[model samples]
Target chain A: MDLAPPIRFELRRGAVTAIPLAIAVGLFGVSFGVLSASTGGMGALPAIVMSATTFAGSAQFAAASVLAGGGGPVTAILAALLLNARYLPIGVSVARFMLGGRVARFVQSQLVVDESWAIASRGGGEFDPHRLVGAGVVLWCAWVAGTVIGVLGGEALGDPAALGLDAAFPALFLALLVPQLGGRRARAAAALGAGIAVVLVPFTPAGVPIIAAAGAAVIGLVRR
Target chain B: MSESWAIVLAVGAGTMAIKAAGPVLLGSRPLPAQVQRVVALLAPALLAALVATAALASGQQLVIDARLLGLAAAAVALALRAPVLLVGAIAAAAAAVARLAGLG
Candidate 1:
């Protein structure tokens, strides 16, 4: 067994590092809550519940957007599924690091979000499960809490776009993406992924292009 | 059940199931060599796609708007090795300012 630090230490480290991201996520969650509340179809209770349970920002936003546009639940669900398909590969990447039995492992796996996973990654397919869980917990709390605030009193906060919160998501992702583009293969995948997404956006439905862009990563399968 | 409740529950369950599928099935087993290679690249590819979609696309139309300014400002911040939070703040400020100036 690898002599790792105690879980608490790693967890604290994860939580500490994640605090900044968590604040941003909370702000995004506020935007989501405000948007969902403004949708007219969804109430505060359901919006909060969605944030608490669904816990995926992009997917939740897509679903809410569908509802806002007067689309039915089926369309909303499909859109969310398209956005969430990335989790399948993400989960597989982190599986070997996950510990515990069936139930425990499953609960812990709930912590596998993009931010948490990135924070936990130690490169070359190694992941620190405790850190993943830690960061996930912090972010989850922030998301849910922010949603509650937004759902309860979002009207007072005024428009999120006016505050430029919408730009935060792209910026956060860009920050995360830059560090990963250190190698030639990663840079190639990023360029390919961005191109695929841009090319497909006009033709495909929302979220579809994003998942389809994952195919760009297959470039890594080529012999170097 | 109400339609809203149904949507919420269905989405919640579906997302949870999707999130659990890979970890539950794979357990602690190591990924195969080819899979590992691809997996390593997945973060970069997916993140880039997210950045593009979030920054450029609005619904079906790829509009050139304040978000582009935000992204450009973010790129500058990243080049300067700014912290993540600062990068987000700078990007948000840039976009908000551009929008205030009626540029989109």
Candidate 2:
């Protein structure tokens, strides 16, 4: 369907799609910032830094959980790394776009996540790099803003877990997941990657599973 | 603020490395078409992996508890294509209620 829809269509769809997902991601991130702040011993600064760079909610949450629970830096880092290893494949998968500008490519990979990638891909073929960048920019701003909100919101709640606000994070992931299951390969690959990731949790470090599963899947993908 | 410098550096460095690692690692050769195809699914796989670990595990053991209850509730919400905000709230509420009820 090379129907080159007006760039306007791509722009509109990209913005619309990116906004809600960004908000969802922002809600999750804000909860994380608040949770990190709630630890009493940690600073809001550290949490924000984690969110800005890591930008990975689950691993960041896991890292914060471990850190707050008195885990060592090594433990926290390992947890975060293992959990975030998924990004490696995400980076590789999207690397094709990074070809033109090495620097931009690097930056792009860093920010790619469930929200941005999904939104960008949906822009259809009409969705050019510009729209993708626009979507990412929107999501990034929203996430950071939401983090502040979540930080303040968490404090006001005093215990976000009390109101079950914590669940919003996972719920956000759920919303992103349905739209992503676009094909059999994707669904099967995801199932395999996740199953491997879950089973390997106890043995592997936090970030290793996604990388491992992606590695495993790559072999299959390449073989076929 | 001083501590934030190191944290900021770390964040910046981390992003720089992960972003750079791809091209540096892959060089010029395109990934096999199959692998490129599979790469598309990494998001969901990662999502499921994270979701399961978060909701289904307690410490080192697998336990069916409030978290699981919440996740299950959220799954229903997802199936129904409920809005994200409502889904998250209901899931968490379900988990909290289950915890309160001792049924988890």
- TM per candidate comes to 0.96, 0.78
Give the poorly placed runs of model 2, Cα more than 4 Å off.
Answer: A1-8, A38-40, A98-100, A122-131, A150-154, A222-224, B1-8, B23-29, B58-60, B83-86, B100-103
Write the residue-wise lDDT of candidate 2 on B1-104 in tens digits.
35434444554566557655865566555777666555655666666665666665555555666676777788898898787667777887887787667666
Against the reference, the lDDT scores of all candidates come to 0.87, 0.63
Q: Which residue pairs collide, candidate 2?
A: A81-A207, A82-A206, A82-A207, A82-A208, A83-A206, A83-A207
Q: How accurate locally is residue B98 in candidate 2, as Cα lDDT from 0 to 100?
A: 71
lDDT of 1 at A139: 96
Write model 1 residue lDDT over A125-165, tens digit each, in one string.
57888889889999999999998888878789988787788
CAPRI-wise, candidate 2 is acceptable
For model 2 chain A, where is the 10-residue window of minimal lDDT?
A: A122-131
Per-candidate DockQ vs. reference:
0.81, 0.44
Deviation in angstroms for A117 in model 2?
Answer: 1.7
lDDT of 2 by residue, A6-69 (tens): 6557656666767756756676677677776775324677777666776766667767777678
